[model samples]
Target: MLALSAVHETLGKILEPPTLHTAVIFTPAGQLVSWQSNPLCAKDDVHLVIGLSGDAWQGAREKGYGMVHHNHLGKILVVPVEDVERKPGEDKPPLMLLALNATDEMEWADMQVKGKALGAALTKSWSKHREHLTVPKPPQSSVAILTGSKRVTTR
Candidate 1:
């Protein structure tokens, strides 16, 4: 089972290089699970993130896509991690909210790639390790990337 530390580590590594400012992993009810933020971020920032993400999550559910928003501050993305195949009466979260705040517009483009990658990694990792971990970290053991039409699987 993975630990919270591992989840934070994965988020740090993924957001640090891309100049992303902050991220919060929250539940559908807006409760925080984990987060990583630069020194510039404040606790209030987290609330704003959750508020935006919660609304976006609802929209995403209706539209059937990840939610990305641009604002004067930068960009915000909310992604839901849900298990469609789970049985009834489970204790798992309905969906997790992943909210990101980038530093600039250019970083938004970079975020799309890294954000989706992070979402995918977390979704897979969490489902596999949820029995013991509050949140899942990206795999640290091996790295894989797509090379051709064959398609690579990392989950």
Candidate 2:
């Protein structure tokens, strides 16, 4: 799991623009990881935005536009956080960064640059932290059966 504080700090820096209302880190499947907003946006709203972004992202790819594509929403910018350390054909999904309310060309440009930096930072953190991820092993035990008055092990 990525550090929430670190993610928020990176997002906070990107949300420097007055028009930029919110920034979210989420998967292409709409799982929100982290977010930072200027006026305290709701989690539900963030989820909705991410969902729309995911659809737009998919549409863009389907149209052969590539990962980086501007959606019809106009104000939202979805940037893909690609993991450089990941091997080819790896099943790991890349994270997406979405910024809300980039009204003009300059703001859009600003978001693109800052969003890329945030993506790179997040990818690095995710790659580093993933090394420490561990799965819990199942417990090993002998099966017990009660016949009449005694317990018998059936391992």
Most accurate candidate by lDDT: 1
User: TM per model?
Assistant: 0.66, 0.63
Q: Kindly state the number of residue pairs that clash in model 1.
A: 0
Clashing pairs in 2: none
Tens-place lDDT digits, model 2, residues 1-155: 55679778878877755567678877555667788888776777777678766766676643311222335333676766766675766655454545444444445567667666776777776655543432333346766678999989876
In Å, residue 27's CA in model 2 sits off its true spot by 1.9
Encode model 1's per-residue lDDT on 1-155: one tens digit a residue. 55778878776776663457777788777888788887556777778778877887777654433555556446677765655455666655545667777766445556667776777777776766444434444488655667886766664
Candidate 2 — which residues are off by over 4 angstroms?
62-74, 86-92, 95-101, 104-106, 129-155
Q: Quote the positional error of residue 12 for candidate 2 in Å.
A: 0.9
What candidate 1 gets wrong by more than 4 Å, as runs, is 62-72, 84-94, 107-109, 129-155
Error of 1 at 36 (Å): 0.7
